[model samples]
Target: MRQDKNDHTNYSEVAQLRQQIESEYRAACEGLHGLAMRARHDFIQARMQRVEEYYQELSSIVGPEAAITTVIKINDAFAGTQRKQEPQP
Candidate 1:
């Protein structure tokens, strides 16, 4: 099977990034951004469900919190992509 360019060759790198992000998230004590957090958590759950059905290998790589952050990033990236795809008026 052909590997995608985004596929992880080192799971450890993913784990390490997750750890770092979790540290930053925990250190955030501003007590704001709750709506964003909720949206991220919801997206993460949906993402994990799809991953379980599609990419079984990566299904276990993310926990709830990590998955949430990842989902947020994914959404942001997708939105940017969509914006780029639109024709400028």
Candidate 2:
């Protein structure tokens, strides 16, 4: 490709601007990641609490086998959601 000869563009200024924008983007990404982590933690904690309550209730109604199955289902649901939220290549 033939380059332009009269290209007197201020590349240094552009480079500085790019660096500033990239730094801001990185900081925003970090903040988002922290928020996501907290949200995921809270969701899992609430889920586990509900599961414990359900397990107790179901155990009394049905049996230990049913309780185990319910627990497995709860785990599978969380795993599926986490997988969906993960980044794809």
Candidate 3:
């Protein structure tokens, strides 16, 4: 099977980034920006659910231990930078 290019090779890093996002979410809300931030957080979370599903499938082949070792690069995902190219007008 072909390997996915975006797959992460460091699971620990992904865990760290996940922690950071969670901590920020747990902090007291700051108002308007906070509300928008919450929305963005929710969006990322739903995306994470999908990632989790993919991991589950991977675990079947590689075993959970290996699967968790690293998958899904977390840096750009946390930065909210993943996006499809849009045609310029």
What TM-score against the true fold does each predicted structure earn? 0.34, 0.45, 0.37
Worst 10 residues of 3 by lDDT: 24-33
lDDT of 3 at 8: 46
Of candidate 2, the 10-residue stretch with the lowest lDDT total is: 1-10
Question: Model 3 off-target regions past 4 Å?
Answer: 1-39, 72-89
List clashing residue pairs in candidate 1.
Answer: none
**Native RMSD of candidate 1 (Å):** 13.2
Candidate 2 regions exceeding 4 Å error are: 1-36, 40-46
Per-residue lDDT tens digits of candidate 2, residues 1-89? 13343232334433443344334333433334545554455454554555566566556545678656755654565456556777999
Candidate 1, residues 1-89, lDDT tens digits: the string is: 33643356446656655445433333231111333434445455554455334222323565556666664664465556546756799
Instruction: Judging by lDDT, tell me the better candidate of 2 and 3.
Output: 2
Which of the numbered candidates is closest to the native, going by highest lDDT? Answer: 2
> All predictions: root-mean-square deviation over Cα?
13.2, 23.2, 12.5
Tell me which of candidates 1 and 3 scores higher on TM-score: 3
Best by TM-score: 2
- Which segments of candidate 1 are over 4 A away from where they belong? 1-62
